[model samples]
Target: MNPSPDLSIIIPTFRREAMLLDAVHSALAVPGLQVEVWVLDDSPEGSARSVIEGLGDPRVTYLLHQPPTGGHPAVLRNRGAQLARAPLLYFLDDDDRALPEALARACAQLSASAAGVLISAPQPFGDDAQRVEEERAYFEQAVAWLAQGPSALRVVARLLFGPALLVCSTCVIRRDAFLATGGFSTTMPVYEDIDFYMRAVRQAGYVAMAEPVVARRVGGPSLISACTRPQMLAAYAESQGQYRRQRGWWEFMALKLWQRLGR
Candidate 1:
């Protein structure tokens, strides 16, 4: 039997066969890391199974939840967490690519800090070069702030106004700590990363690494891209309310208005 894995990389995918295969390969290619790639396939037609079987990698496991779990990846990701055997859990999207030394570096950092979660910056790559460049700069700034150990309020503000640093695919958390936070919110139709990060950082504490460990494939066919404007607006409003409650309504409103006025 294969030895217990040092890290369990959970990838929730649906019908993205080619990208899923590529992600699995990238996870498996991490040098000096004992990793298991768990592909939670929520594909309606079970299309991802063939890709997993085709690779025939022992380190990879393909799980198909029958009757489909709809489009919410949070649900599928939680399911993968339930079956994970490793102590460290890394969530990677089927379309993203982890850098060659990403896992190794993350392992070293987490080992040293023993923090509940480790957040890494992601470099964007796709047809939109300008957007990618802008995203990279944003991530750099966010990581710099995060590395300084800012207060929870500051972190939330950065998340709301600055670039997103704690992307699901770029984060690694201890399995127990993840379960303690009740995993990702299934009710969040979008911005689940932001929701989870807010709670995780508060619950387990976090360490931010500035290196770009993951490559986000921008301009892809994703749930975020497909979300209607109204849907996004509603999600944003809910998130704002959550933050407002934490910071108090007056302070929250004042900060929000100040941000809007570019002050």
Candidate 2:
């Protein structure tokens, strides 16, 4: 009934009610923008309903998938995007917190540039000092490479072999552009963000912002943390095969060589 907001912040959550509340609060706190927060709960028992309703925020919409779709953040994210009413869509993890100026800065950058997607370098927070250090190094490398005006091959190469810059929570994309790109892959249980980012960067192009717009909490038993190393490697291998099929074998080989030579 109400008019659409300037931006839609879609947060896919499962069994983390408290963290989802914090994430919603952070979204609401974003300055200088009219934002609608969509909480897509995939919990089996609709556990997040009470928490979302208790917030009593008009701008927040609570969505629960009946008969529970199991633990698939990528699927929920795509569903959220489909239901989004705003021109801009931001995918935020339920455990992460957006900086006060995150949306405002993203809006400014989108308005100033022709790039379809804008990604921020997130600052790692919480208990894991080791993870924080690793993320910092990764962020530094990613920013440096992004500064060089990377091509589609470079984007894919960095995502696969170098420091990955494809954190879904730090991304802000145009609603139309996102829909056109076919959204995230439903088949990928891991590296789905990377898969989506490679396609998005190639189709619409991207801009990387130096400053962090979100605080990524570490040391938690998240989806990434729960996955075994073998599972991760298998997923990466599968993704690489998909990339070759989609982007052509020759381009993939050329890109791999280009990355190797540059390094």
Candidate 3:
């Protein structure tokens, strides 16, 4: 029998049929890697089922989440994490395509380390994608900070106070740690990733692959836009609570002072 998959990619999609298929195809195109792609479709009527069945590819598994996820990717992603069969996990957006060679390199880097996260840059497409390039550059710069003298401190500081450093499609998360840390939040839809990252970055070292690993088709879709008022409030509240617990205010002040005083 074929060896168990070397990696598991979990994609949470809505009613985006063509894009989801493209994402799955891109995932399966990796050379010399046994990979499984799990598509968690939260679309009403389960439209994605037909798409996966038509491909008839055993490597792809389709799950129709009941009552729909209401555009909450965290809920779908958490479910995918539990059912995954690989030690290393990659989260790919339904609208993005994975770069095979870059993904292969990232997998190798993460495998060499015992407990760490892997981050790679994103190759954006379309007009809205330009902003993604700017964020990708910032993330790459922070990734470099991890190689500095006070590695963990620098990374933790940056992550706590800086702009987002995650593009799920281009990163690798260790499966065990993901589960142990409770994965993403189902209750807090918006910024659930930020909450998850705050905890994960503290627990693991990070492996950085400077090259781009995902071709993200950007049209600015997010859980934030679809969130209800209560959900948005909960998101804001939870993030503020987390910030307080982390002494974020104090740290932010210290970082600014260090920048000017050359500390």
Top candidate on lDDT is 2
- Global fold similarity of model 1 (TM-score): 0.87
TM-score of 3: 0.83
lDDT tens per residue, model 1, 48-151: 98879888888998888776868888898889899888888888999998886977798778868857888888889988888788877877877887778776
lDDT, candidate 3, 1-263, per-residue tens: 12598889999988889988999999999877899999999988898899888998889989999978777888889999999989989899888899998898889888998756776677777576567677556666655654454454455555445555665676788888787667886777677776676566666766667778898766466565466898766775776566566656776566545544533
Most accurate candidate by TM-score: 2
CA displacement after TM-score superposition, residue 106 of candidate 2 (Å): 1.6
| lDDT winner between candidates 1 and 2 | 2
**What total of clashing residue pairs does each candidate reach?**
0, 0, 0
Show where candidate 2 strays beyond 4 Å: none
Runs in model 3 lying further than 4 Å from the true structure: 1-3, 128-150, 224-237, 243-263
**Alpha carbon lDDT of each predicted model:** 0.80, 0.82, 0.76
Q: Comparing 2 and 3 by TM-score, which wins?
A: 2
Tens-digit lDDT track for model 2 on 81-181? 99999888899999998886866797789768887888777888878789889887888777777788876557768676555785887778888889888
